[model samples]
Target: MSGTFQDRIPVLLVEIMRKFPEERSESEVLLVHNMLSSVSMFRRYSGTLQLLLARVVRYQRLERRRVVIKKGHWGHSFYFVFSGLLAVTKDNDGSSAFVDKEPILIKKGMSFGDVALIKTLRRNATVVCMEETELMVVDKEDFFANKMDVELKREFDYRFSFFRSLQLVSSWSYSLIEQMADHSKAEQFRYGHVVVKDTNDMGNIIFIGKGQCDVLRVVDLTSCSAYQRLLKQYADSVSRGTCLPTHGFKSELTNQPGSVIKHKVLLNNPPRPPRGLLADLPTSACFLIDTLHQSSTFGLNQYLMPSKQRDCRRFTLVSQSMEIMRVEKTRFDKLVDNTTMKKLEALQKTYPSDDELCTVFLEHSRWKDYKHSVVQDLFPHRVAPIRSPKTQKQQGHCGPSQVLQQTRHVVNRLKQTKQRVEPKDNKIKK
Candidate 1:
């Protein structure tokens, strides 16, 4: 089946190219193919069916804030994001989708309008282009012609079931849970991959549907009490002349004819001690603060906390072969009522302040530089010497040509002395 599918891809791609009005590179077509593969609606289909779907999918470009589908309108097409962002809103009116309520952002590799197309019902929600978006569109006629809608209902059902099992959304109404499932996209991450970065501004809430993840914090170890003791030990080593070696002046002498020349290279500046001397002391490190398992949700604190307080601490979520259901924070905030928001806020976890850690790192760096300066001042001998070009020239430095000339003159004198000694020895033998 796989080999047959592989063999058909080239022929299918040629058909896809004909569907597009403008020329598309092989890479661009392949990108569209990958995007189609990522869509949840297409995942259940066989490779051959997916390739067939690819042939019928047409390219579309929509400007920012354009409404692709409105609530209560007959669904005519299904969309897969080729590039750019889109928003799905519950609002019937197009204007309110972006103004009154925050809409769920649909990013690249995601699809929309499948629910309405599959059920053959009017679009219950509105979808608008958030930016200049490039989409691969499948018309209702083509969508159903291939029987692509068959497993779409089942996919949604599975998502709805998954949401129902979560205690976090247990208080939510059935309609709300269903809506959440519709907007949420399942994403996978490899083990040890960063699912969410420290203090991410995007503020997308992630629910761990399967596997595990770790919550990590970057810590500045200079603030620790143990570091203070180590700093004292370093200071003692510096004072006792054991921390670094002393710098020495280099001198070279050259004798030619009646004159003796001396090249005195002075040690002007000393080399700074290696930072690795404090290798035992870590300036910064990452600490595993907590681990999240199945059904655990994160990225809520940013929504609950005030802007000033939101990013005070740095928290990163790293995945361990995890599958996650992610929803935009703005959409989440719009979905829940004031009471639910309060409940979520109450469950917000606090972490150590990143500001304090930054301050500790800065203070330690300054102290390190200050300690180096003090060592140079008190124990001047330990500092390495620097040779200045201007000083060398002023001290009658020997040029390469002059040195070669002097060497030749010395060789000739030795040869003349040898010749005179040889003739005297010959006379003695006679």
Candidate 2:
């Protein structure tokens, strides 16, 4: 096993080399040049993937202790800090100064206090990173593009995977990963094409599907695999710094344009959300199953507020024949009356904001402009990760009081709606 793992690395390397035809070095890919030509908004914002927004909002750079977002203040937008550092702080102690008393740090690309956007919720914590931080503010409008493209899909997918991995997936068995490449479509890159980059929303979920992406510093070739291995190994060992390398396991995360990143798939499923409501749900939302039909307080609580991501959608789907149903929200209402919708209100509260994750929304936006006719054909069945029922154990997620509260609300609402719709029988008297 150990020998095969080591041998696999080198074999992957040669594949990228043979695959990259035009250039000997990574520098020649003309990433920035090509990007500038490829996108109109690339020049406007230093960061890539800036153009797809249906709109844009600007905010001044924070110098020293600027109040980008106040703890307890509603988070109306997300800031993309282009330059400098911004410290994130919270008013945890109920002190006068939310900043001076207890401040948290927020670095570039890392968002803060986003949970406060919904239902006029107060910012849970205060955040700060550094000074002179230039930020691209994503207001409610720009953040919630009705359409999603490959870019937004990839971003939401990465974030969804990131948070999900933090929970049940870490302990997942290697055998359980269902050879991801089996379903994925393969993409071979020329020396000039980039496979991945920092903040890229290309929707590329690569795995060591087949060949290794022999990576170098654009300055050297023998350094091939050296940079990839070094960064990856460093990420594995480091206590803090960049995001964990696992989210986009097969792709590189960097900002330099033209820096060649290559990918094949271990398991690839192009995203296909139904052309209706559930498909437009914000990225932060997830499903919790009360599959057993048990009225147990614990079971009910667990499904009440799914505060974290989970592997399965509450129900343990065994048979493959139970087809996926993609109904429009209206169609859903028509199929199941108000009795069936009692649980949804509880689920919807967790994701208080209507704002879809910026990445997910962005991907939808880009998908509209795609020229490939086959692209629209993708995303029929999504084999989301399923936790093994035998080995899996319920963690008892929600509080008893919360469960009671939600249960009462659902039961009451269902009763009221049923009563209001009841028809009177006047014809019998006539």
Candidate 3:
């Protein structure tokens, strides 16, 4: 088995060398390999298949405003972006008028032209370089020869199917949906990953292609009426010497007579609620505003409303092992008509305000604390005893210092007992 494995190594090396074109250096081959792995469409293929693709791809650099492919033309080759941006448009002549339409952009790590080649049909859209672009081109003959058409076809079908099922775009024309499918890329995120942060200004219109996610808003509990009531109750309990242990409080109060006034001032001016992303806050502060399932959409409100009218509350979308399709807000605005835009604006749901969510959270938290306290009072024996400072010190199994302290304590107690017994024996003898 070892000898057979050793014999296969040279054959594999020779095959790799033959796959790469003679013009490509070892460094260039490695660069192409990295590019293929980074691109979503090509990343799913096996290492051998990727290597075969890297072999046939040729480098092409085009200046800004150059037309890579025009609509109604025969599909000649497949193109993958290595750097810079390209715009996909519906214009047949590739005129300047298309620029006003804000066409969908294809950027680095993105690929296009597969739809036309895989279907063996004329190009349905025009792709023009928006910036000086570096592209890796695979001619139609080499693309088909390597059977890459099959994989490209599968990806195109998957995207199309997903877009077709979406109700938001159900009224859209078939061609428009196909164009969207060509531009949008699908991405997967693990559970608890923040797909969109609260502070993001230029957010993408996201469609939950698969799995679930939560829309959460961070609320300031300190501002709510319920929180104020709870705070007042806590203060009252402290004043009555009920909730807190009295041993430390008595000494502190004796040492600092004005501490009560300072405490009240501190309560009145609680530190300003933390500002920034919801992901940075504690989970308790983040309230679930909505749960998004497959086919649900978010980040549309920004496009539907003017800047001033848009909701100012900060929120984030966290994934639960989800697959999402993201379209740039600018691209989506250009894709749909005014009527569809109006319909989407009407469908936007209003979420609970921070003040309201804060009130609810405070009430729920209070009830939970009440129930726990009642349980401890009813079943006192079942509640675990809290260790005292002295007991905690002895429990530290860290080093010899703790053991020496414990020994000294025991010895001091024994000396005190012996001294008391000696005094009592003297009185009895007298």
Candidate 4:
């Protein structure tokens, strides 16, 4: 068995070399044609396949336990694993520390580092050879010029068409969109899976690529009976030294945001109301106020902000078995020029202010004693179905959420109006 195994290695290498064209030297082919045929992405461009195999691809061998790629460095080539095993590891947070996760095993006949063929982005993970390995590699310049650019163009026209339709990104140039498409990664989530939780600091900007998700906010509940119990205790109570009912129970419920002022005022002067208090006081309420669907985006504000500054998530994003595309903030920042940034700033102004959101939350909490609809109008009904322009033509009508369905259209009109007024103003000044 040992002798056969040793003989197999030389035979395989010889076979790979013999497959080259008669005119070209044996060293020139560098890879087996059958291996290239296995990659689905490369199959469509058959006319240029042989040329790509000859000019770009090369064969390389890695020794056991050798690091082939390191995290945080720019990737300039795509690697196809022909034989042996590899281990993949990445940092937990965008930090330099990589001890957070165990290495994932990748076996033979698979490929990795495909993103390197397009954009010059930092490697999110490190790849190391687990044993003596054979690989077929394609470097960036030829890969993009000959093959990947064509695939990326079709991808932008289909699966990622949402990037072009986006009102906020409409002002972005074609080159900028191409750069973003290169750096963005497609990811999937199962039902009931939490994509992003409150207080999480993942710096990637997420755009729903294909499905739906629920935006949730976890809130603590204080039952109506608990509130009334507190009120009754306060009415009957007094200082420990005084002859008032000092033995009544003290409610230890957690405080809500911005409650310090309310507490101070209540201590200074108490309002005595008649006995029959409202029975329907909130036991609990929705803290998260929005339901984002396909094409919806988040983390852009944080992405635009400086990296050194601390930022926290306000809501939790739980997927309903969806697919999403996310782009690293650092990659976007590197690719986007000053002109693109200015257009993005103009687009940002069109969004409803963050101050407006805070006001809505406060109003909703205050109206908890009234009908639910009184505050419900402040937010959209649910996740709105987002279809691309091509799909919209095939589909008959929009889904249930009227507000969300119209929100993007309204924002686009606002942008057009703003531009019109600005040009007129410049003419008037002249």
1-430 per-residue lDDT for model 2 (tens digits): 1122332213323333233223323432233233223322233222234433312333444555556666676677755444455554445332333335444444444444333442247676655534555554556544555232344445434433432342212343433222221122222333222233221222222222122222111112112243234345545555464442222212111111111111112102223322431222111211111111111111122233454742122111111111111112232223333433454344321111111122222232233325222343485464656777652332222222222222232222223332332233111000
Query: What TM-score against the true fold does each predicted structure earn?
Result: 0.55, 0.27, 0.54, 0.39
Best by lDDT: 3
Model 3 clash pairs?
none
The deviation in Å at residue 49 for candidate 1 is 9.6
Q: TM-score of model 1 relative to the true fold?
A: 0.55
Location of the lowest summed lDDT over 10 successive residues in candidate 4? 245-254
| Residue range 274-387, candidate 4, lDDT tens digits | 354322222222222344577766666344445575234245666677878777667766766666566555322112223322333333333432433444456557556788
- Ranking of candidates on lDDT, top first: 3, 1, 4, 2
Q: Candidate 1, residue 277: CA error in Å?
A: 6.5
Q: Give the C-alpha miss distance for residue 416 in model 1, angstroms.
A: 86
Candidate with better TM-score, 1 vs 2: 1
| lDDT to native, each model | 0.58, 0.31, 0.60, 0.50
**Stretches > 4 Å off in candidate 2:** 1-50, 92-122, 145-212, 215-430
Between prediction 1 and prediction 3, which has the larger TM-score? Answer: 1
Backbone Cα, N, C clashes tallied per candidate: 4, 42, 0, 0
Worst 10 residues of 1 by lDDT: 258-267
Candidates ranked by TM-score: 1, 3, 4, 2
